[model samples]
Target chain A: MAPSDERHRARMARKQEVVAAKVARASRDKGLLLVLTGIGKGKSSSAFGMIARALGHGMKVGVVQFIKGAFSTGEEAFFRRFPEEVDYRVMGEGFTWVTQDRQRDRQAAEAAWETARAMLQNPELGLVVLDELNIVLKHGYLPLERVLADLSRRTAGQHVVVTGRGARPELIELADTVSEVANVKHAFAQGIRAQKGIEF
Target chain B: MAPSDERHRARMARKQEVVAAKVARASRDKGLLLVLTGIGKGKSSSAFGMIARALGHGMKVGVVQFIKGAFSTGEEAFFRRFPEEVDYRVMGEGFTWVTQDRQRDRQAAEAAWETARAMLQNPELGLVVLDELNIVLKHGYLPLERVLADLSRRTAGQHVVVTGRGARPELIELADTVSEVANVKHAFAQGIRAQKGIEF
Candidate 1:
């Protein structure tokens, strides 16, 4: 082996020892609550990715769309193909900025939350995704405390993913994993329209 | 209608007008270079989500794994099922931290880049995902300028997604969309092992 390779090997051997120690210590097994939030895109997309992951493991998944019912999305179209494994629902009338009616939006959010609560209670589900739930909570369409209460009461070993911009502090605190997607640059900001498959 | 409903209608009507005008003005149609980076999870997951999106549209996709050859991933297993649609290759020997041999790692990255370059040249591919390319770039296994040059030469309507932490500044500047996934809380930080299907 080259001298550089020998040096690298020695360095990695030490690093592996440390990583192995940490890995050995990490033995917990339980359901995780993951939050994907912030102004950048890919929040709901990542949640759908987890749904895919869960499904790949031959586990059932439930998906509830809280605020993107105005149009059909690529994820919904694709995941819905697995009707037996995926309980998918587009429960929102539309985004608040689009629907505009506060009462209507609140009612829709409540209905969506009811469906989400049902999924959380279902022990058969391995993963439950509440897509854009943060936006509903942000708009105060559903009480944050009530949402938190329901989330906290989810069945054991049932992972849940809540995604959207402006995630509440309580949700963030309760989540096992929280990822904030920061926007460095966006096509829309550069006068590019949202494409069919990409944006949806 | 209620008085509040009337006010909401007026507000949304105005908002719609503004949104429609903006949408109409933003008419550019071209392939996008998206970079997902930072010290958080879901970068590659989000890219896989896009692969799902592209597949939903009956579009062809290519996926190249640069630094995750140590084990099989849920994404590889899932996407590879549709062999007709996805051209998947796990080109890396493993992560640099794991493989340790800098020379070997550099050879693997170069080989991966050659495969990636071929895919980028193919106009029929609607989306191409370079999984963990940023990590390869970060370790100096591949020249950033060469990668950038090849990326610039991609077909007009072929979208590309490059994911991993420590994305180079030059690549970030060239990307049409850039998202930095910020780590707020992680399960591993709390001594929880990476679960199969979720972390693979």
Candidate 2:
């Protein structure tokens, strides 16, 4: 290509760069209700990231782990150390597969929902993460419509994140930002197994 | 509470739900980049959701995997079945910790960057996921400024995602959406081990 042609391309590229940056900046101020859905790992992990970020910004943060019950995560371990800043709950049930009781899962989900609903209503709550929540919704353990209704009604400026696999299309439609964590290549797939502090 | 107070509370609660739903809907058409950062599993998985959704909408998609060179993810396995619709690359060198060689890592990053840059330049690309890219920037193995500049210059309709822990502040500052996965309660800590097709 001619030098002049190359220069023209460079100039156009630079112009495009400026335009893209401006557009991204405009989109940042927009609040999003993200849905991290997919048949993969990391939905809760991604949700927890937002929880920590919200807390870091001095934003009120609340977390309700539907299937996890009251256990310690690397995040809760750190955040719960200063309990005043975080409202954390773990539903004490492992998962549907482990527990293998829909009725019991439903009870735990309902119990967790009470807390989640409270968090959603709190105007001071900047971020609310419903970790592993889709399982509850998917298993029909929780009423999807009510959960969506409550989530839709969260206080202004409050951001809610719902994470789990098999997220319903209706919920995805309702979400401001819907993300699916599709299983791609994973180390564990190679028989490496999950390493603590890495896959947790 | 007085009867009037109870009625007013119900009314206000209902209003909040509507408003939250409105905000979420309005956010969809607006293209945005969300980063999933942390030591926990599932960042790439979350990104794949966006890729699949984008494709479902008949939107063009591109992916650049930083640590995973030439290997295929489960999603990739599924997605590659429709190769004509998706552009994907897996950096074969794996993670920085695994490669353990700065020069090789840089070369791998550069190779991944080359593909990513091309994808960024493609106006037709609707969603671009740079998986496990945080490590590259965190370790200074890749130039942040160039990545940022490229991202800024990418197509306005394009939504870019970056995944990995220890992302640079500049990258986070530039992100339209930022999520950090914190380790709260993980089953791995209990020696339950990561089950196949689930954890992977």
**In order, how many clashes per candidate?**
0, 27
Model 2 residue B188 lDDT score: 43
Give a tens-digit lDDT track for model 2, residues B1-200: 56754554566466657654554544334345557776545466557645544554566778787887323344555456568767878774864444445667778889889999999888887778888898888878788899999888887757787888887888877765555554433334333333222233
Q: Give the per-residue lDDT of model 1 (tens digit) for B138-187.
A: 88899989999999999888889999999999999999999999999999
Error of 2 at B144 (Å): 16
**How far does residue B163 in candidate 2 sit from its true spot (Å)?**
3.5
Q: What is the C-alpha lDDT of each candidate?
A: 0.86, 0.65
Q: How much is the lDDT of residue B51 in candidate 2? A: 55
Worst 10 residues of 2 chain A by lDDT: A189-198
Show model 2 residue runs off by greater than 4 Å. Answer: A1-30, A69-72, B1-200
- Tell me how far the alpha carbon of residue A154 in candidate 2 is from the true structure, in angstroms, after superposition: 1.1
Query: What's the TM for model 2?
Result: 0.51
Q: Interface-residue RMSD per candidate?
A: 1.7, 20.1
